[model samples]
Target: MPIIRLMLVFLVFKSVLSGVYGNNSNSENDSKVLQMLIDCGGSVTSLRNELQDMKDKLERLRSEAATDTYIRWGRSSCPSGATTVYDGFAAGSYYTHSGAAANHICLSKKPKFNYHYSNPYKSSYIYGAEYQTYESIWNNLHNHDVPCAVCHIPRSSVIMIPGTDDCPENFKEEYRGYLMSGHHSHTAATEFVCVDGHPVTAPYSSKTDKDGTMFYFVRAKCGSLKCLPYEEGKQITCAVCSYSP
Candidate 1:
């Protein structure tokens, strides 16, 4: 009887060991499956993020391409029989009038404008003599009362015509009209029609006066004008012009 009992105990122990080994094998297989799933999920997430970034870049490129139109014309494109009156670079500076109680710049003598001078209000003005180079204007600006100035290269001719609201003949708008700031505390003027005898205008007609103020014309259309960097206060004006082909 004792011998029979020992054989039965040994059989029971072997059966328990076999069950434990089977459970461990199943657990190992389950762990491998879970790891694979995790890796695949991470890859999918990374791919989605990359695709979104690519889409954003493509959209920005398209928007820039649509509005980046600037036609560059040389001196040869002037109208026939046109007498070039002022054909050099021009610079203007804004300053506070000593007793006039206004902030403006006077360019009457520099370009020799015969018309009644319209003093447009501005915060800062370019210093030094007229028609200064960028470097010279920059240097003079530092020593002046206001540290900001506007410079331009103007080409204009004296062709008399009835004053009309339209842009001058033989000229085309180069850039969409927009307000340009001196990047300072004061706003600059935006309504001056002729710079160094050149017929020019802000493509879109509007006014603003604020720090860091700006606007861009959409679709080369005049009506879609909007202000930027804040919408309140007076705005300084800047002009963009090009010779007509």
Candidate 2:
């Protein structure tokens, strides 16, 4: 449409020039007019190509901005249709340690180190995480080393809702699982995280309470949290959701 409009305007200008010059125009003026028309046509072709290039760039930017990434705790693989960035073992600070990070980390299986720093004095440590959900819905996973994966979803945003197993309206559910955190009685408090419902353990990991870091299911207390929607002494559930737009 832009090119068509440009052509119409150019045609009207040409008609005006033709009327002004009539048959009394010199050969030099006619040659100049021909060159001017050629230049206008070239400008229109160049502008069209630039416009197409700009459209292509916008499409690429939208695609690049659409992705969202998160860690899939207690599972070594991502949900169907999601891409795995890296698969690793879940790790965190010692349960009794008070001077370390309060958050968990997914340590890559194949690590690349620039240089090793060997410290003789006591230093903060992160250890392999284990499931402590005994006598509960995740009893089967008790004492098993937890595995984790970094997943990338082709969506604009991702969120972890701790109180419900279902995603909110207009969002796609990436996974649903139990809300887990450190033991309430532990000296060091930790942030809660969502673990996959059907979790996978690390390969060749033994079923023992090594207890470097522990994962315990979180329970709700209805006094301040309200009883109609939440039940006392009931394990909380969680859902990971991905949203587009």
Candidate 3:
């Protein structure tokens, strides 16, 4: 009987503390909502309803985009943007040996993508260019389509650069470490750029001959109209980006 009385007293004390700490239905519900969000995957319909509600609220403020903000690029935005002006599929993939040709999507703002995946560098087959194809996705934007095609793709095809058996003598340890660290994105080489200026080039060497060709897999980096699209195999340089070399 004494133990039971103590247990009841503890429960009452706990309730009193909770009340003193400003407990309310709204706060409780909000906490429940947050937990629901954390456990979001299991409740598809509820999530969809929540998303739809968000979309409805968003539409009141912005122009109605054809796709949801979180929707995959090509799945909805790409074709939707392309079809906003034209009548055919623009960003469809079909066993691509190379990505779209002569496209550039670099701009101050990243246009909606057909597909976006985080940490794309380690995923061998994924390729996202520094620019998206403005011409292809023009209808989706209010501004002039700069018509750039920076590709972001995952490339797993193993075409080894034949000449590269060792690292360059002056290759910065920081750059090498950057690669070894499994961080996919390399920057303006503020940290370290290739001596030859092609950071993603093949064989880790500037040398390109019949035995091996330098291959560059691309990723989508931040840029603006300054970036113009080139073909998948087309060699680009500081001059091509209009660096005034």
Q: Find the candidate with the highest lDDT and give its number.
A: 2
In candidate 1, stretches whose alpha carbon ends up further than 4 angstroms from where it belongs are 1-25, 68-245
Which of 1 and 2 is ahead in TM-score? 2
**After superposing candidate 3, which stretches have Cα over 4 Å from the reference?**
1-14, 17-52, 55-81, 84-234, 237-245
lDDT of 3 by residue, 1-245 (tens): 24475456545655665676666435565455445444543476677889999998986544332222111111111222222221111121112323322221123233465565744675323222211222332223212111212222111111111112233332211111010001123221111111112122111122212211011323233355233453332222211110010
Would you list the C-alpha lDDT of every candidate in the order shown? 0.32, 0.86, 0.27
Output the lDDT of residue 40, model 1. 64
TM-score, each model?
0.21, 0.73, 0.14
Q: After superposition, how far is residue 225 of candidate 2 from its true place, in Å?
A: 1.2
Error of 3 at 184 (Å): 35
TM accuracy, model 1 = 0.21
| Model 2 clash number | 0
> lDDT of candidate 2?
0.86
Badly placed stretches (over 4 Å) of model 2 are: 1-61, 114-116, 120-122
For model 2, how does the per-residue alpha-carbon lDDT over 36-104 read when each residue is reduced to its tens digit? 766877887899999999999998898677898999998888999899999999999989988868999
